[model samples]
Target: MNTIEFLLSRRSVSVKLITEPGPDDEALDRILRIATRVPDHGKLTPWRIQVLRKDGQARLGDFLAGRFTARHPDANEKQVAFERDRPQRAPLLLVVTAKVRKQHKIPELEQILSGGAVCHNILLAALAEGWAANWITEWPAYDDEVVRLLGHDPETDRILGFLYLGTAAEAPDERPRPELSDVVSRWPQTA
Candidate 1:
């Protein structure tokens, strides 16, 4: 599809069951480069990418399971297993982190927003490449233990968006979006 058509038609496949994403090193590099082109006020480029392959996914799942077990000694086996299997939901995952620099003239919130834009770009780029992608940030993503395990700087506030990449077993349905009239408003008067 063309660029405009791609943007308008892009939809995230939540129930991803693809056999493989097959994003080779070159293709992945291109995707990452595109993702890095997001808006940055001070050009701080406050974002980091953590690629999690299949094995890494297992490790993450194990870590989460261990964490859950430690937090609740009395938790059931099913709960523990569920935590361990969570990461296996996706074939590959990319952890997008906001590496905020506090002393910068730019506000911390803007840095976080830039990180969010990076996540969106990752999703869009994957979509444009004929891959299924979804950006997810759940409780595990916000867990301090998980962040620490991921080696993010302790002093900096961060946004953790897990971008799942894979083939789509089924085509995604386009959801309703806000109309222009509902979202946009012209300025009432000029200065």
Candidate 2:
């Protein structure tokens, strides 16, 4: 598809519906390269990508499940299992971390936004490569323990998103979007 068509039709496929046959080593390299091509004020590439393969996903799931059980002593087996399976939903997971630098010319907010842009770019690049991708920041993204488990310094880094990448089990239907007329407006009225 062309750029315009791709931009208009692009939609996130659910992590649960994302199957195997995700991008391989070379494809992932290209995707990562594309993902970093975002607006970074001061050129301080204040972000990083951590890839979680099948084994890594399993380990993360186990860690989360253990943490959940510890935090919620009354949790049932089902709840623990749910936590354990969270990261296993996709074949590959990309953890986007925003390493905000202090005392830099660029504002912290802008650095964080750059991280967000990185997430979006990853999604678009994966889609362009005919792969289904979804960007999610669930409870783990906010959980310090989980962040540490992923080897990220929760103090200096924020988890921008957990991008799930794989083949779509089936094409996703488009959801409702804001109407341009309702959302767009020109500043400084001419009338």
Q: How high is the CA lDDT of each candidate model?
A: 0.84, 0.94
Q: Model 1 off-target regions past 4 Å?
A: 15-19, 72-74, 189-191
Clashes of each: 0, 0
Give the candidate number with the greatest lDDT.
Answer: 2
* Model 1 lDDT per residue over 1-191, tens place: 68998777778888345447547788788889999999999899888999888898899999999998998999999999998988777677899988998877899899999999999999998889888888889778778888888887646856469888888887877789999989888899456
Write the residue-wise lDDT of candidate 2 on 1-191 in tens digits. 79999999999998888998889999999999999999999999999999999999999999999999999999999999999999989889999999999888899999999999999999999999999999999989999988888788889889999999999999998899999989998887668
Report how far residue 1 has shifted in candidate 2, in Å.
1.7
> In model 2, which runs have C-alpha deviations exceeding 4 angstroms?
none
The whole-model C-alpha lDDT of candidate 2 against the native structure comes to 0.94
Residue pairs of candidate 2 with colliding backbone atoms: none
- Give the CA lDDT, 0 to 100, for residue 57 in model 1: 88
